[model samples]
Target: MSDRICCPLCRCAEVLLSKAYPEQAEVLALLREHGPMTASEIRAKVDKSIGVTAINNRLERLRAFELVARTRYGNGWKYIAKPEVES
Candidate 1:
């Protein structure tokens, strides 16, 4: 059943981030490549024209799955990917 799916976007959310949402997935890939970085840093590093607020919002959404982590940096937060957990 659809309800059995771990993610509505991907039946196998564990392995299919890119397929679930390519644009949003880019945020994840970017963090993986850059390590910990502020939302503004992430926005600048990405290829698209998204706003910093949007990047911050995406980071929050990604946090729902523990796909991302955050640490206080200066007066704001830096987002980073959680260590990949293999099954």
Candidate 2:
């Protein structure tokens, strides 16, 4: 991977990434590399071994932070990264 760990939302520099959990950072990086995806897809995409429950939890947390947006997709939600616009 490219190692440029900027926030998928907010465009925060690597410094801001420290605020997120390691898993959350990984999730964001995955989304950035790919695109919008479901929690399941994220779990499958990440290189490290992560559980579905953990991936789902991180997705929910990111969405709650407005770093990512979720849309209803069948029974689950499809998550997308939203760039944070400065006010």
Candidate 3:
């Protein structure tokens, strides 16, 4: 993956990703830094208030934006951050 992860929404200064979707950004950063990981693993490292379901929800939304992708791993799924999309 070349260690370069990027998302239009993440790069957009207008939206201020940290302020707008802190949880989502944190999730993305985790995946980018740690390589592929299951949703449960993400839930474990994220804020105590964020649950597995919420992590899954964030993964789904990230998938919709092409910022991250998930692959079947055993009985669960592992997510990987996608490279930057050229505008």
Of the candidates shown, which would achieve the greatest TM-score relative to the real structure?
Answer: 3
Model 3, span 1-87: residue lDDT tens: 223425555466315655677777788889888889999999889887978999999999889878798899999899998866655
Q: Can you write out model 1's per-residue Cα lDDT over 1-87, one digit (the tens) per residue?
A: 122233444446634766666756788878877789898888788756788888888899899877888999999998887765433
Candidates ranked by TM-score, best first? 3, 1, 2
Q: After superposition, how far is residue 2 of candidate 1 from its true place, in Å?
A: 27
Query: Which predicted model would earn the best lDDT?
Result: 3
Q: Residues 12-79, candidate 2: write the lDDT tens digits.
A: 54336645476787787777678889888998887547788889898887777676888899999888
Which segments of model 2 are wrong by more than 4 Å? 1-14
Instruction: Order the candidate numbers by lDDT, best to worst.
Output: 3, 1, 2
* lDDT head-to-head 1 vs 3, winner: 3
Candidate 2 or 3, higher TM-score?
A: 3
Candidate 3, superposed: residue stretches over 4 Å from native: 1-10, 13-15
TM-score of each: 0.75, 0.72, 0.77
| 53: Cα error in model 2, Å | 1.0
